[model samples]
Target chain A: MLEAREPMSAEAAEVSRPSRRGTLYRGDPGMWSWVAHRITGVLTFFFLFAHVLDTALVRVSPQAYNEIIETYKTPLVNLMEVGLVGAVLYHALNGVRVMLVDFWAKGPRYQKQMLWGILVVWLLVMVPGAYFMLVRTVTEMFGGS
Target chain B: MTLALDKPRTPRRPAARRNNWELASWVFMRVSGVALLVLVLGHLLIMNILDGGVHRINWGFVAGRWSSPFWQFWDLAMLWLAEIHGGNGLRTIINDYARKDATRFWLKVLLYVSMVLILALGTFVIFTFDPNFDA
Candidate 1:
């Protein structure tokens, strides 16, 4: 603990560089949704940007776009597809939780309980989805008729 | 102000603000994200790689793709889900970063407007796509 404290002291000075007063909402557990929504939104947006660029290449030259699309036909692309959709789904679902907070459904008192609910549902849905993406399709694709 | 679930936790005050919205938004992101996982990944596999690849995709392909009610519903679901999920995610960002209440409100108005427009347009395209316009 002492060693951990020693290295962090220098970083702590940087961390505490304060923003304007009244601007900063001292965070609670629920507030993390607001933060995560931004992070995952931005991450998903980045992938979307790449997708648009790839697809828009069709507009520039259909061949070029098709060529790119052809490359995405690979197993690597399947994994990427899974990742991209996973990112979008997680961001969207957690974002809904954040919206519920806005409407005042789950508060600080129930934050922990609601967070667990969120996790449970996320895994439940995503696991099946992952199977659909990674296992079922690949099995069908590669396994000979 | 406090709201009670099992029992009334807090007394109703005349002008109490609200509880945390941030949490619900977080939940939305996760839930919709899981749905998208299925919709989007299945879409990619069926469309891009399952058959002989992009060469197999053409006008008849487009018509054939949408022929399935399953794919149509899947696309429709993905379109609206992504839009709402993305829109709500943006709303969270706005609440966090937007400085003024007026600014936040107006920005969200714009976001929601765009969301509705895009959602409508995308759905319409899916439902009424003309695969044989030049045929």
Candidate 2:
């Protein structure tokens, strides 16, 4: 019965086309890493833009700058600072990984290792920073109130 | 690695345009990314960690820093490089995801407008800042 089976025709091949969705989430680590990198990059950019604009307010007037800075010291903004820190950390680490991949001969072969290394370094740096950012800001903002 | 005689000879296509925009953008990403890493990390340390962190930041603090040409140039370079780097990354993303021509075109237009506006505003504020101006 197996020997008697005919090969698929061109029409059948066309009808049974693979969906693009399958390729999108096929559990490829590189694909997911790239996605995360892009997202973190964009988020970091927007945050930096806002930061520049707000900092620029100092030029307008001291009072205006002080008021805006005070608003940023609120608990809400401090909480978001955690997210910003995470994004920046990830983007910076992964950026180094990307650079190595482009420049180093063995980088492409060991990309997975590099990614894991980046994650370890990111965790090491971010954990302490996050603790400082959250604990210090929350205590300062709410302890007095 | 000579071509085999049995292989079919395909017609050679004419070379495309000589402009190196893609190559330039690729190189820019790597160089700018490395620079941004240093600038951004220093900024984070100063603004978010050292000397009482964000709470310490105020008009006087900024004025004091900007008083020096070094700080001005540091910030100006950061602003310019980051904006261009980010805008290029977003342009690549828009080209990838925006399937419709109109959608891609308009999205890019919006991106360019915002990028220019921010860059101009940031540069102007940095240079024209008058710490002595009374409110």
Candidate 3:
């Protein structure tokens, strides 16, 4: 037996069409960067809230604070610290790009170029950063010789 | 015969209620963003890249850093600026995504409540931090 398909509305038809102009931002690099910025910003904010609370544990007692903080020193969490650094770095670098786009005389013309520039800078910074951040973990796990 | 023109789109808010708050918020994001790049990057360098990373961080380490007024001020500034900056970013996101008025209002209420609590708690911790608590 043949199955019946539901009719598509004009809006759904437009969306289903393989047209480049269907969406406003249309998955451009600018749009992706904005998406990343939002994601990173929210993640960083939640982390900040937790960080403040954990730091507040000092008031309770050193042991209490240290016990919780110790979890941050573990290998898995150290890896996450690297990821956090990456997120913050991208957010910061792209933030400057956004500022330049808004304020600089020729910024709008070079926004794409600046995005590429920031990504390069982000890579250069993050490589050495990740290495330094994970060195202790690596050494500890592998037996420092 | 002349063709009739379509009515112009209505403005979202009344002209009488116009203000520079949005412009100010836009400016604040860029300015605070630049400041945070330096402040946060420096913080990361000192805390996570120098000597040993999180391995060296403990109550004693925190005590040592907070003992200096310089580090204390650095941390306090970082906390306040970062919180405000992040809060504003989230507000923009909420406005963009929440279609219904009630949804938008409740989301913002939650956002502001958390922002206030975090700011208050962080400020309190920085000010009342006792380096000799365990002593």
Q: In DockQ terms, which candidate is top?
A: 3
TM-score of each: 0.48, 0.84, 0.86
Cα lDDT tens digits, model 2, B27-119, are 888899899999988888788766667778889888888889999999999999999998988888887789999999999999998899899
* Cα shift from native, residue A11, model 1 (Å): 22
Which window of ten consecutive residues has the lowest lDDT sum in model 1 chain B?
B1-10
lDDT value, residue B79 of candidate 2: 93
Candidate 1 global CA lDDT score: 0.60
What TM-score would chain A of each candidate receive against the reference chain A?
0.65, 0.77, 0.81
Interface RMSD (Cα, Å) for model 3: 9.7
Model 3 chain A lowest lDDT segment of ten:
A1-10
In terms of lDDT, which candidate is stronger, 2 or 3?
3
Worst 10 residues of 2 chain A by lDDT: A1-10
* Model 1 lDDT tens row, B4-76: 5543455664554386565566566666766876786567556534554433654455556667887779878
Clashing pairs in 2: none
Model 3 agreement with the true structure over B22-56: per-residue lDDT tens digits: 77887788778888988998998888888887789
What's the TM for model 3? 0.86
